[model samples]
Target: MNIPDPQTFTDPEKLRKLMANAVRLGYEDLAFNCKLRIAEIAGAAQDDVIEREFWTALIAAEEFKAAAAGKTSRLAKIRTKHRRVGAQRLLADMMMEEAVSDGFETLVAHGRAELTCEAIVLRHEDQFSVDAVNAARKKLMDHGVAMTDIAA
Candidate 1:
């Protein structure tokens, strides 16, 4: 199948309508028409209505999020908990980076002994990043330790 570009139009009203339709159809149907409408109304710039769509998408998105939020109490709780594990990993990663940059290593005692710094970023010994270093910086506080310098 072929997918069309989302920037073929230039009218706000049309884009809004298409977005409404896409929202009505649920976020899954972000089709060619929908993307075109968005790109067009966004003034042909990719981020034109970044704020508007953010709020609008949330309003349009709540139904899906809520539906996914549960089928039963226990299952829903598990899903939410699973989602939170990402946040925990993020926090632990931060602590690791902080320790490493401060010229020491950290022990992430999350029920096991894992050297946080050793897991990410290769030092002089040619080691692999243990996912403690992000694929790219997801947080503002961390830098790409390789080929990057702290702004002075």
Candidate 2:
């Protein structure tokens, strides 16, 4: 049900896709949340820190691109900065995924209900093979858990 807007290219355009993904998922809120979380992770405890982190990443990205393509123009620099910020955000998402996975395991073990995140749903759908299901059941024999009531 979630669809995002068409992507727009910028100087570096690294975060463009992520921003678009957020828009598509109707996750403007998530986008905002990520931005704040990213800021915190990058040591941006204040407004200036956030700006500094963003600019520093931007500068590094631009430099990297310039070295890669032999183009050291101002445009390339700007593009590099944005691209770098986007990359940082993308990597942070991985950490978030690990957290989600650990949380899901904990909740399920405790027989507690938890909010379903999109990644978990997608992963479950992807990993739910009949053979895989049987394998898991066999693996859990010592834990006294059975996969009989699993919902496909």
Candidate 3:
């Protein structure tokens, strides 16, 4: 499935159409990934309202399609059980360490830091808080890394 560009997310009509196509194609995972990507983008944009709406609508569509097909919602399967306190912090720390060890400086130089951070957060969404992700992105920016240097 062709994923809509992140820049087009600001257009509700376009986003809705893209999601509908995903649902029709039985690409629930694609829809979910789009939601995760949007979450990262929305956090960067400081637009929680649109993110929440997008999240709700996408989940609903996925659920509806799953019900019609007599299958469980992929979203339900992806949600992890609640974790112990500090577990998320540990995961965030490990992720940061791995990023640094992977030559994050080079990634920043190539204008990939922001997308890299978003990918990390989305890959471990259940184990990281939005605040932690935002802080990491901010730290990169504070070190003279431009978060908006590259288009995703």
On TM-score, the candidate that comes out on top is: 3
Clash-forming residue pairs, model 1: 6-35, 6-36, 119-130, 120-130
Instruction: Count steric clashes of candidate 3.
Output: 0
Model 1, span 8-104: residue lDDT tens: 5466556556555655666545533453344234322334232232222222223233323432112243235436663234334443443332111
The deviation in Å at residue 38 for candidate 3 is: 25
Local lDDT at 148 for model 2? 39
Give per-model TM-scores. Answer: 0.23, 0.21, 0.29
Q: Give per-residue CA lDDT, model 3, range 1-152, as digits (tens).
A: 45556355764445556656776888765554554444444345434432333233334344344435556444332123112323234336534552442223434543445334333444345556676666566556566765455234
Candidate 2 C-alpha lDDT tens digits along 1-152:
65433222222343434544675777765443333333233333325422444333334333333433545523443345446664234223322332333322332343321111212222243434444433334433333433432321
Task: Give all candidates' CA lDDT scores.
Answer: 0.33, 0.36, 0.46
Candidate 3 residue 36 C-alpha distance from true site, Å: 23
- For model 1, the stretches where C-alpha displacement exceeds 4 angstroms are 1-5, 31-152
Clashes of each: 4, 6, 0
* Clashing residue pairs found in predicted model 2: 3-24, 4-24, 11-79, 12-79, 58-81, 62-80
